[model samples]
Every structure is written in structure tokens, then in C-alpha cells.
Target: MTGSPAPVPDRATRIVVVGAGFAGFETVRRLLRHQRRSTDRPIRVTLISPDDFMLYTPLLPDVAGGLLDARFVAIPLAESLPGAELIAGRVDSVDFDGRTLQVRNREGAAETVEWERLVLTPGSVTRLFDIPGLAEHARGLKTATEALYLRDQMLEQIELAARETDPAVARARRTFVVVGASYAGTELTAQLRALADEAARHRGTVPDDVRFVLLDMADRVMPEVGEKLGDRVLEVLRGRGIDVRLGTTIDRLTAEAAELSDGTTIATRTVTWAAGVTASPLIQELGLPTEKGRLIVGADLSVPGDPDVFAAGDAAAVPDLAQRSGKGADDAITPPTAQHAVRQGKVVARNVIASIGVGTRKDYKHNDLGLVVDLGPRFAVANPVGVHLSGYPAKLVTRAYHLLALPRGANRMAVSAAYLGDAVFPRPLVSFGLVSADEASFPRSQGIPAPDSD
Candidate 1:
């Protein structure tokens, strides 16, 4: 047996991580970095995601405006994440007791994945409520496909607005209503408005009269970004000719118009849904106790009553006692943000190592490192280190943070260069229709037969 290597184990202790978003990506990153292949039995980490890349969702607004390379946001799983099997598919459910997951493959076939330890980072989906006609008329900007679609729609609207001498159709094409004031919505509103405004000048017919309206049910823009920055964002949006509508929402979405609750029906064809996100339905499938559609876990990031099960990211309802629990408050859930997700993922990995007999388990704890909002080229709002910054400096910090957060180091230089290139020669305003103009109001397919009881 001197020359021959030892025979491999027939059954490996598998660790399956579902969803390759912020949580799943970092979880796998930590596992591979910490685990030593020679001394340790190969930890079979299988990551199940619909796409091979982990999308940096915050920068999706830049993609929509064609300011950043669309491919820059996606990190291919194969680039790193060694020893982890990456499967491209939608996972239906996980049977906790059986330690198995039911995932549908590329060919729409089902396969069973047995695991010793499971990390359910199924992430969140866009929350689309029943707004009348919105499903038929709106254009979403969530996924890469949606971003591309919106870009085409914007360019289409500009061209159409240019061709039309009709005052009504021209105005309709110019007006855009964004039904959320969160980071995604705010950034999209600012960037797209800037892009369209520039295009309008070049085309001559597309209006300098182009308008954008950012609406939210909350009293202030970016309610999560705090009142100070929210006010600044409101100002920034308004400064860019984007009408900031607060404490308001769309009452009805018609084929050619959006009727607002404030008795304002904007005649427009574009409505971007960036209101919020809800946890994946896979969490409910576990038959485990969940807090607000997220798996309820202890500080250790492990599922309660189940030793092998773990959860993180937007899917996990992490308790926030540090920043939340005040004078009269009871239990408070952590805000579903990327900052929390990244920190929680590492903690999850450490805990998983403990489960695998590597080291001691540690609880997830993160002090808030404030948020940054990218509002087009030179305009941005940031509250880094609890210090408020607006205009240009904030934009610099925002871009830098995203560059640093990107999965690959190569992407950093490339992303930075593009930003510089845009500063020099702006990207030509053009759109290729990828996702159809038929907008989607619902997050997932309607009447999917309850996803099958299997």
C-alpha cells in the first residue's frame, strides 16, 4: 500500500447550502478557507442555486442605468468555492429528519440530496402585492434579466417619446413612477433619470421634461437609512427632478397610468417594484418554528431543536437586541440587509465547523456599520461609521465599498476602471429587449400547483 492511496469513503458527510446569495456565498467561503483537506474528511458542501453566480444585488441599479458592467455583479461559483459541489437548480424543500433536499434540475427533473448538516440560505424574493394592472403593465428591476429589461424599456420609452408628437403619449413616456424609496428604488430612480435626461438632450424629441417619481408608504425615503439620510435622499431625488412622494403608494396600476393614493395618477408606462423582499417559501417547508418566514435560530445561527440545521441572510429572522430592544420593546428582528448577512455567514461557518468536530461554536454578533446609497454618478448618500456624507464624497465611499465587497479582486480593478471610463466617456444610451415589456407584479409564478406536495 506504499504506492497506492487509501480508498475513499463510500458515503461522505454532506453539508448542503441552499441559495448562493450573500449568506450562502460567505458560508462556503469560510468553510473552504478554514477546513484543511488533508487532515479532515472532505466536507461535501453542495450549494444549490438557480444561477452559477452570486449577484451583488445592491449594484443592480448601476446595471439598470448601464453605468456598471452587468456581468460585474455576478460571481461565478466555479471561480472559487472549492470542495463544494455547485448545482444550478431551484430547491423545492428540505426534509429535516431525512436530512435531504428535493431540488429540481435544469431539465425540470427532481433529485434527492442527502446531507448530514444543512444550511438553508434560500434568501428572499421580491415582495409583490396585488396592485391592480401592475402585473400586466409594470417593469421590475430585481434580477439581472429584469435590469436588462428595464434598460431596454427606458431606451424604448425615450425613442417612443421622441417619435410621438402627441402631447399625452410624450408625457406618458417621460413620466416614471418608482413605488419604493429603499436603496434599490432610490438608486434606480436617480440613475435612470440621469440616463434618460442625458438621452433626451441627444435625441431632441425625448424631453428635458422627463420626470421620475419615487413613492413609498413610509413617511420618509429610505426609512431603513434613517431620517437624516432619508431627507438627504429626498432632496437628492428632488434635486434631479425626481418627484419624491412619501407616505404614499400606488392605488391602482392601469395600462397607461398609475393612480396614487394622493389623488395623483401619473400617466406613465414604467413602474419598478423595489418595495421589499420576503423570505423564500422553502423555510415554511421545514415544518420548523419560524419568525416572520425566517428560520428561528439561536445566536449560534443553528436552528432551534435541530442540531444539524442552520440558516442565515434574509431567510433567518435574527434577533436584534443591541440596536433594537429599547425602553418598552420586546423581541426585535434584525434588519434584512447585506451587512448583517455577511457577518452572520462567517458565524454560521464557524458554528458548522463545531458541528463537524473542528472547533468551538461562536454566536453571530454585528454592530451596525451604516448603509450607503448610490445616487447616480456624482450624487450619493452615505452614513459610514455613523458619519453622514452626501454628494460626491459619499459616492466615492459607496463605490469603494462595493468594489471591496465584490467576491473577486480582479472585479475590483475592472469595476473601478468602468466607473472611471463612465466619468470620461458616458456609456451610450441603448437597450436590447431581453425580459419582455409585460411586467410582473407577483414575485413567483401564479397557480404553480402549490409547488407539488412531494
Candidate 2:
């Protein structure tokens, strides 16, 4: 009895991160860097995601418009995240009280992993509405697959239009409708217009025949960049022959047409729904208090009652301490943008390390660093550090900003080469027919659950 006392098992502190978007990827990278620098307490880091790569989503419009190859924008998690256990799985649920997660791996097998500390950065999905035919025909630019599919679909439609005997059918095939005049929708409209123009030149068709309609409920195109800059973007878009409809939105969508709220029905085969995004479904399933579908967390990103849990990015409603000077508490939250997400990721990493006794905790605070909108070749609108610029000068700042923002060196080089090639040569107009319509649908690509049929 004296010799047989059971040997207690020893386990290192486990930290698990969910999702591989900008926030999660950056958090994991920073955490590993901290771990490498310090020889302190032994801790195991694990990243669980359905994808094995971190997608550079800001460049998705370029991919959709055939400006860049798809592979270059994807950063492989396994290679970039050394010394961390990469689990290819989607977390189905989390037992917050028990400190365990129920994950369904790529092969659809259920597994459970315990975590002493957890970071939630599942990101956001396309905010869908109850409009008819939307879920069936509308697509988004959130994933690389969707981008590739959009490129192929556009080319295929243009090719089909070239041989069509019916003028009405041809017009419908060439028409492209994009909702949401914000960053993603605006950039996509500009790039796709360029793509359609190039396709028109090769087909010996009038570029004007290819119609582009950009819609938004907001009064201005991109209100985030202030009214003056937003007005400049509107001017550039309209000057380039895009139908920029402010204070407008789609009422319904169909495979062949989109019905606008203003009683206009646009006949089109493609509808890119870039309206906006809401936090991932997992946040709602947690049964916790949320502000506008995002988890409520302190300025330091820690969950209210759960000290071991932290959330950032679009999934978390992080207080905007930098802007909290005179605003109400409810109004002082960071807008869910890529810039904020990237900076928030770093803060989350630092705090997570501190929670495990490796360092001291710090609150997240950052001022607005301006915005950039690339409107095709030789045209852009940028406000760099509060100085507004338009046209060619803005274009230079926009490109440089992207190149610097891209994390991987290889990606930056590849993107730079693509830009140079774009300047020197005509774009190739061909579709490989790789992604099917069903495959690129929102339910399949962006993880939106199919609505219940009545």
C-alpha cells in the first residue's frame, strides 16, 4: 500500500486557438514567437481549423478578377506555424465550464481536446437576409474557392454571351450585379468591370454592353473613409461607367435577375452579395451575452466571467478605447475591419501569454490608420494617416499598403510579379471550369447553414 500510490500524470498547459483567419493566424504566430524567446513554463499550442491555410481575403477581388493566382494568396499554416499542433477540424461546440471542445475533424470524426486557455477568432460570414432566391443564386467573395469560381463563372458567361443569338439573353449574361458599395463590393465592381472590358476587347464586343450595377443602402459609397473621400470614390466609379446606386438595396434575387428595392429589376446571371458580415455561428451557440451578434469582451479581450477565454476579430465586440473619449459605452466598439483584426490579434497573443504567467497583460488600443480602395488600374482613393489622395497617387499608396500588409514574403513577391505582368500584358481570358455552381454556393463555401424549407 505504501509503494503503490498511483503515479500522477503530468501535462503541459494547453492553449487552443480556433479559426485560421487573420486574427487567429497572427495570434498563433505571435504566441509561438513568445514561446521561442522565453524558456519559461512549458506550454503546448494547438490551432484547430477547417482549412490548413490562412487566406489573404483582401486580395480576393483580385483573384476573382483574374489579377492574381489563387495559390499565392494562401499562406500554408503547417509551414508557417512550426512547433504548434495543427488540427484540421471545425469546432462544433465548446464546453466552456469544462474547458473542453468538441471538434469534428476533416474526415467527420468527433474528438475532444482540453484547453487551459482558449482564443476564439472564428471571424465572420456573409450576412444573409430573408430575401427570396438569395441563398440559391447569390455568391460572396469571402473564400479563395468563391473567388476562383467567380472568375470562371464570369468568363464562361461572357463566352456564352458571345455566341448567343438573342440580344436580351446576351445582355443578361453580360450584366453583373453587386450588392454593398463598401470596400469588398466596391473593389469587386471595379476589378470585374476591368475584367469584363478585357473580355469584351477579345470578343470584339462593345465594353458598354457589359453592365455593372453597384448597390448599397448607405447614402455614400464608402462612408468609412469620410464623406469627402467617399464622394471621390463615387466619382471614380461613376466616371468608369459603373452604376453606383446609393441608398439602395436588393429586394429579391434569382438565377436570371435581381429585384431592387427601388422597383428596378436587373437582368443578370451573377450577383455578388458583399453586403456585410456577422460573426460566426459558433458565437451565437455559446449562449453568452453579445453585442450585435459579436461576443462581448473587455478592452483586454478577456471574456466577462471566463478569465481563461479570450476573443478578438469580427467575432468579438472589443471596446474601442482609443475612441472612448466622449462616446457612450455602447457606441465605443471597434468596427470589424481587417486592420483592426490584425492589430487585435497581436494584443490577444500578448495577453494569452501573460495569462499563462509568461509576461504582463496589456489592453488593446489603436487609432485609425486611414483606408485604401483600389479601383482597378491607375485609379484609387486613399487616406493615408489623415491625408487624402485620389487617382494615380492613391493607386501607388494602395498597392504599397497591400504589399506591406501581406505577411508572407513569398506572397508579396508573387503579388508584385503579377502586378508587373498586368501592366505589361493583356489578361488571359479563359475559364478552367474547376469550381461548380453548387460548390461555390454560400452554404458550401462560407459555412452558412442551409435555411429550413417550408
Worst 10 residues of 2 by lDDT: 1-10
Quantify all predictions' global Cα lDDT against the true fold: 0.78, 0.88
The backbone clash count of each candidate, in order, is 0, 0
Query: Which whole-number lDDT from 0 to 100 does residue 303 have in model 1?
Result: 86
Q: TM-score of model 2 relative to the true fold?
A: 0.96
Show the colliding residue pairs in model 2.
Answer: none
TM-score of each: 0.92, 0.96
Number of clashes found in candidate 1: 0
List model 1 lDDT by residue over 1-454, tens digit each. 0012123355546777888889999998887765445345556567888887888888888888878777888887887675567787888877777778898876789888888998888787766677777656665666777787777788888778877999999889878888888888888988888788668777664444888888999888887677888888787677767788888998788878999999978899888878887788777777788887788988788888887888999999887756554542457777798888888889888898789787899877677889989998688888987898888899889988998899887777778888988889857787766566533233332111221233
After superposing candidate 2 on the true structure, give the runs of residues whose Cα lies further than 4 Å from its correct spot: 1-10, 326-330
Scored by TM-score, the top model is 2
Against the hidden true structure, what lDDT does model 2 obtain? 0.88
